[model samples]
Target: MDGFDNLSASEKAEATELQRMIAVEQQKAQFQAQVHSFTDVCWDKCVDTPGSKLDYRTETCLVSCVERFIDTTLSITNRFTQMVQKGTQ
Candidate 1:
């Protein structure tokens, strides 16, 4: 904050935007990691063998399981966000 105060308006704006961009990238990386984890878990649950191509049933199971996992994660995230907001208020 002390260093930020010495920055010119343009420099401050640029710095803020850079910080926002970095936050967005970090979020994207976290989401990618979640997706990877979801897929790995679903693959283990749905896949019996590593064939050249997945059969229809296995593919469907993987999709359904991943969707449910993402949905559950979003629901929990939303609940936690609400709780944090309520606490702050």
Candidate 2:
């Protein structure tokens, strides 16, 4: 690409907006990857395959699984922070 100094004002603005859109797309992709990973693990533990679309029981279980996973993460984070504060490895 030519240097930004050679670009017209509108071209520069377009480039900047394109860069922002790319960043947003990257963030969305990363979030999707995390969700897929989480779903895979949680499905293994909670899902038994779809039986005619999602049943309420399975839906509830999946919700609980995600909630508990996040709760576990938060608990571990707090504990690790306390350990660091106390200079404990």
Candidate 3:
């Protein structure tokens, strides 16, 4: 904090912008991590192999994979809530 206070106006501004950039990069990294996790799960469920390019069947499977994963997440969440409520009562 004291070091930041010693910074010139321009340096402070640059630091602020750099902080913002770092925050954005952190968010991007988190998003990428989520995408990688989803891709890993979905790829196993969908993609059999990679040859030259993605085939129509694989593409369709990928789409279904994401949809089903989301659906499964929601379903589990709902059921978990219901189970908790039932237990509480």
Candidate 4:
């Protein structure tokens, strides 16, 4: 690919915006994948069988399970970020 320096101002802005859009899309896709994985795992743990609708207890369990998954994900991510910062320093 050609050097970004050769791009005109408007072209540079357009490329930057496109890159931002791509990043947003990637984040969306990653979040969706994570949710799917979490749902599958929580389903196996909290669900006894497929029903027309979930019972209150099962519903609560699923919600808590998903929240726990989110909390763990955030905690791990924060730990990794901290480790990276420490390494850089």
Candidate 5:
């Protein structure tokens, strides 16, 4: 049987809303995983050694690395979108 078939109208609406919320949370978790992966890669690439504290130079480098990664991602995504649109025409 359809799962919602047993639910009242209000319950059905609530269930649908819950499903939407779950999807949104899943997207958020996936985004966080990507960010963590990026940070790990960037950290290894940018930091030469582990320090007891974050010095100004290392902090700047990490920030720059993340920013550049984001910028590159956006640039590539935009170009890909344009290419896809052209191909569809």
Candidate 6:
């Protein structure tokens, strides 16, 4: 018998929905981890030392670093996607 055979239609639907929600949450967690990693790397490269207040120059460098990191990530992802698509074709 199937795992869900004992469930009513409504119950099965609810279980499926819950599974989808769990998958979504997992993806969100993974994305958060990637962002944290990016921030750590960018911080080391952009900031000279910790200060009580962020000076304008340091603030600008941090912002630019993050933007470039994001752009690089997107470019790599797009290239990988294209490669996968080409391989499948």
Please name the candidate that would achieve the greatest lDDT relative to the true structure. 4
lDDT of each: 0.93, 0.86, 0.88, 0.95, 0.91, 0.91
Q: Encode model 1's per-residue lDDT on 1-89: one tens digit a residue.
A: 44789899999999999999999999999989998899789988999998999999999999899999989998999999999999999
List candidate 4 stretches off by more than 4 Å.
Answer: none
- Judged by whole-model lDDT over C-alpha atoms, candidate 2 comes out at 0.86
TM-score of each: 0.87, 0.58, 0.55, 0.90, 0.69, 0.79
Model 2: per-residue Cα lDDT over 1-89, one tens digit each: 65678889999999899999999999999878868977998888777876767788888888998888878878998999999989965
| Candidate 6 local Cα displacement, residue 21, angstroms | 0.8
Model 6 alpha-carbon miss at residue 81, Å: 1.3
Better of 1 and 2 by lDDT: 1
**Candidate 4, residue 83: how far the Cα is off, in Å:** 0.6
User: Between candidates 2 and 6, which one is better according to TM-score?
Assistant: 6
Model 6, span 1-89: residue lDDT tens: 54888899999999899999999999999999988987898789878989899889988888998888889989999999999999999
Better of 1 and 3 by TM-score: 1
Candidate 4 achieves a global lDDT of 0.95
Tens-digit per-residue lDDT, 21-52, candidate 3:
99999999987886788799988887787788
Name every residue pair that clashes in candidate 2.
none
List per-candidate RMSD values in Å: 1.6, 6.4, 7.1, 1.9, 3.6, 2.5
Off by over 4 Å in 6: 1-8
Q: Which rank order by TM-score, best down to worst?
A: 4, 1, 6, 5, 2, 3
How many pairs collide in each candidate, listed in order? 0, 0, 0, 0, 0, 0
Count of backbone collisions in candidate 3? 0
Candidate 5: where is the Cα deviation over 4 Å?
1-7, 79-89
